[model samples]
Target: MSFFYSSIVKFEIEFFGHENIRSNHQKTIEITKESHLTPQGDCIVGVNATSSCADLPLELKNKLKNSNSKIKFTISVGDDEFILEGRGHPELILAHTKDIVIRKSDFICPRTLAIKCDKASDLLPRTMVSLLQNPKTKGTFTIDID
Candidate 1:
């Protein structure tokens, strides 16, 4: 018998913080491709994102569709780096064009990137959130599926 194993898939997204970034939502965190952010987008940490859920590679997306897949989401800005862990679901249809959201709840939507995330925007470090409120801050988001 032949054996097959799948390897981890990883990708990075570059984004810039927006002046309106609140990073205060209790249940979710988000990065958006839109050039502008409203004050009401309290979950948004970064805007002008280089990639949305729709921009992810097919291989990565396919792996993320597996319920057994574990995901690591890392966000780095300046000298601060934060990591969040979550799980993927078979019901995920990651096809949103403008946003990628990680949620503390199991609610799945086109914009949802991961579910049952360990941290939400409100749980982020205050220093990091302050940096994210500045439009000049550069942010890197890395997604790893294992």
Candidate 2:
């Protein structure tokens, strides 16, 4: 028997908000299927969540660490609001490059915004959390990646 080797690629997204309270919300993360494809394959969408202060819940974090397929997650924070981001693998990358629409809305109360790659697949939730938790992170914040 012969097996093919596939490279695992991960794409990361960053969410920027005016304040900490404007970063946490479910409507902020959105996913839509692409229109066309060249080679054609199953697209996997993974949503990762991290907080500026602490790691996501052990259960959720463990789930992401153990998954070999597409998955999404909803994370909580100690603060009022936070930013959410997502990343995926090759399948998702193909879909994204094809001009697929992955709309991520923002929180309504404080009003927040999320940005995603139009031609890339996967999102690095861990890195995003670290970035937001930098010493420069002066305000409270949270993150969700589902």
- Per-structure clash totals for the candidates: 0, 10
| lDDT top scorer | 1
Q: What's the CA error at residue 64 for candidate 1, in Å?
A: 0.7
lDDT of 2 by residue, 39-119 (tens): 222121212212211223443333333324333322222243323333332222121221222224211211111223222
> Relative to the true structure, how large is the alpha-carbon lDDT of every model?
0.92, 0.27
Lowest lDDT 10-mer window, candidate 1? 2-11
How many pairs in model 2 have backbone atoms within 3 A of each other, for residues 3 or more apart or on separate chains, i.e. clashes? Answer: 10
Report how far residue 50 has shifted in candidate 2, in Å.
18
